[model samples]
Target: MFGGVSGKGRTGPVLAVLAAAGGLVVFGPAGGSADAAAPCAGRPVKAVGFGAGELRLYKGNGYACAVTAAKNPGTRRRMSVTIQARGSAPAGDSGAYTQLAGPVTVHAGSRCVRATGAIAGGGSAQTGWVC
Candidate 1:
């Protein structure tokens, strides 16, 4: 399982195929300042969600990152991003993607990546799922 979205049961390759079919490209570094944007820096892929907020995905340098933006729903919410090599679980001896608090960026050096916005009140939404 990829952590948050359990029903998809989809693999990394499938997600990557979907992303590519959607016109998204693999990202890489562009020489400049460290602050300079990567190839996929500003572009974000939208994910499935509950329609309460906005979720975006960014991929670069073999890592995938996510950002979530929501209106005032009066609840504490945070975004999570995770990634793993193709056909690998989020947890195992293979080492899973490092989880990070978002809209901050994270290094998901895996073949596939997933993101979700979790509310402190026990509600959550999938932000992005891609390879």
Candidate 2:
């Protein structure tokens, strides 16, 4: 059964799917600077506790990136993630999208970010990131 309410004050439909599937699932709003197109940066992703999850990120101006996790090959358990970046992106391609990653454990009374991998194209990869 679902145990807690998210930052949004309710368990969304996506979470319900995870609970029914009997595996860990993580999700959160796409993080980054505020730009007109920034909202398209990433789409929500889902994964089974043991299988790999695929995260699709959309960059402004039609560029996009996909982040995938290698199979855990370990015990199935609850997973959490946190997504962060150096700064926000500008209105156009001139803006820079910094580090983005998460899939870490959620601490007591805290939520996980849930993003993982590099910013998008050829940038430094973030640490403790998961999707």
Candidate 3:
């Protein structure tokens, strides 16, 4: 269940998919599917910790990104995905809002962006800032 709105006031049931698990989901505007990478697509860029969870890195569509297949434990718990452009503060992170299931895909814009995922008290994981 997502709980926030984008600046455009657009919102829906977007699902966060885990890249390592090769999960796929198709929803309205809120959810869609992305390619899963074994070692990841394109040249291995960078990767960071995604809490206790696992993550995969990839590059496609002129963008570098990290994908995760995370599902809510049915306890009303929420997972968050964030993306920060170069020189941007974590507080300025812009990405998917908190949701029940995460296949959160954070993309790098321009120079590079840092991506992160986390659950309540579950810590967080991040990716190396890259193209």
Candidate 4:
């Protein structure tokens, strides 16, 4: 007889429809959510201009104070620069640290410093300066 399509077979389509509806409920557009971007968006100023000719260090108000130099020919050096954070200084100083390869010299009255080394893959020399 038609005993093959008896108990469980008749409910298969219903179960499938329920499963599909459940899936829709779980994965619907209304249930989806988006992620927000981080508070710190742009590249850190210290991470820019590595292996270049010179680098400039600025205070919170964008006042330039120091410069970094590129690595000397046939020489390897690690250079680092630190700019104190605005109003966060231990003794009322605020700036940032931009590092580059060196032989770095901060000349008097100069607006940039030099790092004497090859630029690493991270877009900065290994001066160990923290922004």
For 25-79, candidate 1 gives per-residue lDDT tens digits of: 3454445653563223644555544444544567767655564444344444443
**Alpha carbon lDDT at 84, candidate 2:** 36
Candidate 1 residue pairs in clash (backbone atoms < 3 Å): none
- What ranges in model 3 sit over 4 Å off? 1-44, 71-76, 87-110
Q: Give Cα-based local distance difference scores for all models.
A: 0.48, 0.32, 0.47, 0.36
Error of 3 at 110 (Å): 6.1
Candidates ranked by lDDT, best first?
1, 3, 4, 2
Residue-wise lDDT of candidate 2 within 1-131, one digit each (tens)?
44544556465765777776654323444446355333334433333222233332332222223332323324332322233322322111212222212222222122223334322232332233232
| Cα lDDT for residue 12, candidate 4 | 78
In terms of lDDT, the poorest run of 10 residues in model 3 is 92-101
| Every model's TM-score | 0.40, 0.19, 0.41, 0.20
Q: Which numbered prediction scores highest in lDDT against the true structure? A: 1
Q: Alpha-carbon error at 23 in model 3, in Å?
A: 22
**Runs of candidate 2 exceeding 4 Å displacement:** 1-75, 87-131
Model 1 lDDT on a 0 to 1 scale: 0.48
Between candidates 2 and 4, name the one with more favorable TM-score: 4
Report the C-alpha lDDT of model 3 over 1-131, residue by residue, as the tens digit: 34453445343333233332344333323433343323234544554555444444555555554544344333444456554557655422223333322333434455666666665655667676655
lDDT by residue (tens digit), candidate 4, 1-131: 23345575587766677788889988876632322311122222443345443444332232323334443333343443333323333111112224332221222232322222333322343323333
Clash count per candidate = 0, 13, 17, 26
